[model samples]
Target: MEAFFKALLGEKAFLLDNNSKMIAPTMEGKKLHNLERLLLHVHVIVEEAEGRYIMNQAMVHQLNVLRKEMYRGCFIVDNLKRQGTESNNYKGHDVSNSFILSKFNPVKRLFLSDVDIHRETDLQQVIDNLSNIMEDVNGIVVFLNNYPPLYRQPYSMHLFIEKCMFRCQMEMGRIMAFLMQKEDQGCVGVLPIVGPTFVGKSTLVANVCNDARVRNYFFQTILITAHDINSENISTLKDGAVILHQNNALDQNNERLLAIIELSGDIDVVAWNSLLSSSSYLGRVSKMIITSRSDKITKFGTTQALVLTFLPLEAYWYFFKISVFGSIDSNDHPELQSIAMEIARGLNGSFVGANVTFSFLKDNLVAQYWRRYLSSFREATQRNVSLFRESPYGLVCDCKPITQLIRGDDEFAVWGRYHACPVEENVPMITMKDVIFGRGNYEGEFDVLAWKSHIPPYNSYIVKCVIEKSK
Candidate 1:
């Protein structure tokens, strides 16, 4: 969705650039400045609209329509500028930068060269078309700034952190606190780790799972990755490294079991239901941990949803150094370290790039060669499309809205998609309406009504969120 708006803005920028060269001098300086100002306004509006586009399809359609109208206006201006000029001078120059995407690939040709703009006269038609196109663009800018809409944004990251995993220390502590907390006996707990793909959900969970405390707290643990949740796959899950207790809890020696389910957005509700309903799993006194990109899947967490966040730059620097140089501290290689940091800045928060790029560049220890690679990488970022699109970092970075959710100001949705689940006849159907938000008289202070599920004698479960209110 962001890309859709970006491409739109890019075309508009390209057209505005063309007009600046061709028409700037033809009109008054003030008029040219106004055009430039309008162009800048549109760019800002579209960039702001990126997050809003996720939930509103109609907004996208309107923007696309406005984009076409702008393009048609550009086409007319190009034609008008070409009138009576030599064929060679204006043959393809007008369309040169207009059609070429930053990555050097040509986007689909959406507009035709031949357009019929009916007018009372030739001179009048050109002026009218240009005026109308500008008016349409202005109208679009106003519409976007005034009325913002939202739609769902999709997300799709690497590295091994030998030391502190960025800002995950607190997150690890939180999960551990929940898992190790002394609570109702025989009650099962669920922790869902949700974030965009390759944003280190698995790594964070793996770190937590392998924690000495977690291992000691649970008697047995199962780590299940995506697409490996079928009965056949899950039965085989425990066949390898699992340590199952042979006795029941009544023996006073039975141990608790932990199952960690790693998932992506593609998993369906049916698969989730099947996984949750597994007789061997979801038992009293057992706990489940889930990791996925979809917010919807967090509904199964039972506790508050754990939304993974991007590492702070300082933390990411240490992570990158460890991921690449292994214990060879950056201080040892001053020059190389400087260039590495420069390149790392472009990686945003993607651990995927830190690991993969290091692997690719690991062969060359030459300082000069590393500098050259950094230079090219930086240039590509400016001149071309995202080079890391195939890599986890690029995939996540390309989807800016998800990046915003993880690291931006937007609040991540911890709960939604409530419907009735088949339970005993006595259990009432739970609907979204049952879940309510309590008002806050003070700023950032709020409360919510959540459902609680018990186990046996208590037969209810209470879902919670980890939001910190300003109050």
Candidate 2:
């Protein structure tokens, strides 16, 4: 495959430098500024689709990349001016730091492989370049590391044929009406997307990112957790842009609310009013989206707020299978699937709880861990699950429930109580060693089991985010 690509492009596969075979590496981490870092370039030129249907997905997959470049790096798109029936919008981006993805249209044959396609850009370029793959292969390679879109955009609007599992229960009519029509001129209605955790709240936001109309109107995403957004956060979004708020809790700082009022023109609000409210909320053309387990947010916002509900039974089944078994079918575990479906029904439409429960249930269905996870699920329902809480140290825990109510700012969702401990001023940052090895009876400031820290941020923040360990 490398030889074929090399033969097609006639470019030096590797630059001869001091007679050493070097791997072409990305320049993101290597230097503060550099480009043209693509180690291997696959160029296909097509003029005639004759001779063995010369387009194969496997061949493209065999290349250094699976040719599924959508989420890999920078991307750019240019649409040819052929409107009315078929035309794509123009977009410019840092190609050196973007991923390019594509599909085999009727005009072209694409030999792709098991590749994760994120976003497709530049319809004209994609069509023309893909169309020209049979002719000549000569292009540029680059190296740049752009942050992957945390919330992936959806497919092309022009190409949208049907809604998938993610769009279930979302009232497009309501959204389109709210986004397009502006009645009374001073209403920025809110919509609360109610669901348990992981039930596609974030995924819904990802879909919102792809809508061409929405993207054109909005700016960057500012994800605010209960601990993140505050009076300080509003100063950040005061300009013209959209803010994506998540992990919102009522206890977040009042600063964010004040900041919303200060924001300049045309910032679409993608959060619930329960999450935020102000006298000035009416002045902006913002559509607030809130995903929560409760409905208090809707009451606080404009009267026209829409309710984005949970997935229908069918969609839940699809999501369950995908998140669990990696497929949309039960495969061979029909009985387990039935049990899982019953559990979903019992979840009361909380996708988050269902997902968390399913994650453990799927893997440990036959192990002791399965029973423990299931039991935990049942226990959690009775226990009032809270968000983050204040700690003995100055820093708050963003991932655990509070012990006791200690004048918490928004960063710490002040809900419960804890036995306060005065931190000795110069303790660097709490670490796992402090949680386990530090010789002191940790009186209820926080208690997390010894094992939770095995993960990344949790492992790093365990000492700082003290949880009360269960005996």
For each candidate, the alpha-carbon lDDT, in order, equals 0.48, 0.32
The superposed Cα distance between candidate 2 and the true structure at residue 183, in angstroms, equals: 6.3
Maximum-TM-score candidate: 1
Error of 1 at 203 (Å): 1.6
lDDT of 2 at 444: 43
TM-score of 2: 0.34
- State the lDDT at 430 in candidate 2: 36
Candidate with best lDDT: 1
**Predicted candidate 1 versus true structure: per-residue lDDT over 348-443, tens digit per residue:** 666545654675455566666775565445433432233323322344344421111111122321221121212342443332123211222222
Q: What is the C-alpha RMSD of each candidate to the true structure, in Å?
A: 23.2, 21.3
